[model samples]
Target: MAPAITTLAAAPELSAANTGFMLICSALVMLMTPALAFFYGGMVRVKSTLNMLMMSFISLGIVTILWVLYGFSLAFGADSGSIIGWSSDYVGLSGIGVTELWDGYTIPVYVFAVFQLMFAILTPALISGALADRVKFTAWALFIALWVTVVYFPVAHWVWGSGGWLFEMGVIDFAGGTAVHINAGAAALGVILVIGKRVGFKKDPMRPHSLPLVMLGAGLLWFGWFGFNAGSWLGNDDGVGAVMFVNTQVATAAAMLAWLAYEKIRHGSFTTLGAASGAVAGLVAITPAGGSVSPLGAIAVGAIAGLVCAMAVGLKYKFGYDDSLDVIGVHLVGGVIGSLLVGFFATGGVQSDAKGLFYGGGLEQLGKQAIGVFAVLAYSLVASAILALIIDKTMGMRVSEDDEVSGIDQVEHAETAYDFSGAGGGASSRSTAAPAPAVTETKKVDA
Candidate 1:
């Protein structure tokens, strides 16, 4: 038989520069998930660290299948209604051949599809942090599959899909303020509500297992976020991409400083965890508003989110919700601050038509921003809670009491996060913070 092959030609008018840039941007965004794995993994107790990392890794697998199957079509296909798109036309990437562009965009359909898929993968992984060390791995996987289907796809349609209601209403989500951070954060809250707290939440130390690893993860995320925020423009030859790139850095740095300042004032010392969390908060806050605002605008937004989220982390105790890793505080609260502030700071130079309230646009954009935030928050909260309830009632969302107390890592995965016994033929310890296997009192080996 003749060799079977397929061919692709660049979109005739495609700016090769943009396509190449976005391909790199897509890879950068993909890296953020693994970076997230490390970030969340390092934050949990040592025993559950591996499981935390796996929670993020699994999203890469599950969401990849769903997106290729029907997720993309439902979110981005030809609009059948203002609420959702028609999957029948583009399921598994059928009907539209690879040669076509993504409508008005310069990138090939395949590139845009994959780039957005990175966002889809990262969003669910963001929720895994809040459920650390408590849920069954199987149940967590199932929750991600269902939550993304019911909440993420439809919300993506509402915000970014052509002819979508929110898109038509002119709510500005340059990247994914509503679709990503807030959506995952609210879902995290809902699941925790259904599943209850990790065994010794408030009383437990629950400190970061590896502050160095956490710092590394934060650094990687900060680096990769350039592509995430600026690439939203989908092109850099335009000056707006540069504006966004600078804004991302400025906002993140400012936020970190603000967070550290808060820590020093309230806790009497700065902590590494606070710095990393502050950086992420800044990134989340800038994501939706970076394109619309100036660098100073970004700094203001980032600083506010850093301060607010630093304080919000304490809400778990006051409200008694037990968000194990503070997902609700940073992502949900940061996303809201960034999205709403655009109404106040959007100066109409680099992005968007309508100016912000501070720029003389009045409350029109502010009202729209609030509506978008509340809409996503409400829908995700309700949908996620229902999904969690179904999973908890069916397969059981949480692990057994013994399993939790014994360490969900080995119970769930039959593996230890950091095995040292293998190096010297010593037995593994089952203690919560298991130390290196001891050297037996053996005579020194004759050398």
Candidate 2:
């Protein structure tokens, strides 16, 4: 009999290598939340850029606090109803010993907890892009706090936690295709519906204020995703981890090319925005399939995602939802493309007991994959809408017309993303247009 194409090595009692590797991966994943801030920040108008960044940044602060308090317990604790888990022992991470391994893994429980915390932070941030330029900062903060509690905590349990019903049912979300992307994407759509469209909607020329920032954020997310996907194996120097890493790159490259090609054909220009957005689409699509599909299969997943997501972004125009930065188009749609295709493209050789329809595995995996995808999308959409409505009725969701028109960053954050006031060198004299105080120039826009 042939050996498995991807095989994970049995972990030793305490390999400093694996633990340290996970630690680094955890840090890398942490950086992605801020990188996302830059990405989303650059996409909005200059007036609201700081507000866009704060939306993503606040998630890191809020989710981190909640995760340690009760989020982790509810997400990873011993199963209760196959729906959610709750155990006071795990709450506040009280019972987890310092030297103890996390169940069958080689890393400390804290490493896994922190790593997943990064995910919880990034998921709601992903939703922020959809509701940009309109939401009240206080309302957004309150919404995310409620969101992680009601929506994110339980969804993570269902997909990743021990004894999760999806796990029991054989659904394969190698690393948060359903839990993160689909979950967040659906939630983005739901909240957008409740908050309504940005004031200008289709009439305004809302191009990205800084394409280079978006590109940089895309690069960081691409870099950190290696840890997000390969690290899910929980150990490296293994065949499965290597395969996942390889597939991740290939899929991203393929998706980027496909997206650019589509843009050139349809829009007559291959834009930097398209390239950056394509890379994210590829990353999101391959995330769930990387562990189970071959490198060739990864290309297929990426290419399909690039093309489909490129088209999906237009759904908002036809449907008339705001989706300022196309979160639903890219994440929700890209995640579904990746998750459902896994059932058709999964290979047993690459991953034991994992074979899709094309490999003679039948429709069992496909059926299961669909169930997981729709279930997450449905739950997130409904729950998020309810949360948004409750917040809208009570504290109010949208900023005042004056705040939205005058600028959300100035009103909410008391800051502007740029201060052109210091453009008084040989390149330019002190122009009257430069008003805000110039603090510093942190990054150069190559794009």
lDDT of 2 by residue, 313-425 (tens): 99889989889999999999999999999998999886557799998899999999999999999999999999999999999999998889999999998888888886556
Clashing pairs in 2: none
Model 1 lDDT at residue 166: 88
How close to the true structure is residue 221 of candidate 2, measured as C-alpha lDDT?
A: 92
Query: Which run of 10 residues does model 2 get worst, by summed lDDT?
Result: 424-433
lDDT (C-alpha) at residue 64 in model 2: 89
Model 2 residue 447 CA deviation in Å: 62
User: 1-447, model 1: which lDDT tens digit per residue?
Assistant: 999897886644677888999999999999999999999989999989989999999999999999989999989987877988875757887766665777877778888888899999999999999999899999999988998899999999999999889899999888888999999999999989999988887887888889999999999999989988888888777698899899999999989999999999999999999999999999999999998998889999999999999999999999999898899999999999999999999998877777899999999999999999999999999999999999999999999988998999999899988976546433343443457888888787888
True-structure lDDT of candidate 1? 0.91
Cα deviation at 338, candidate 2, in Å, is: 0.3
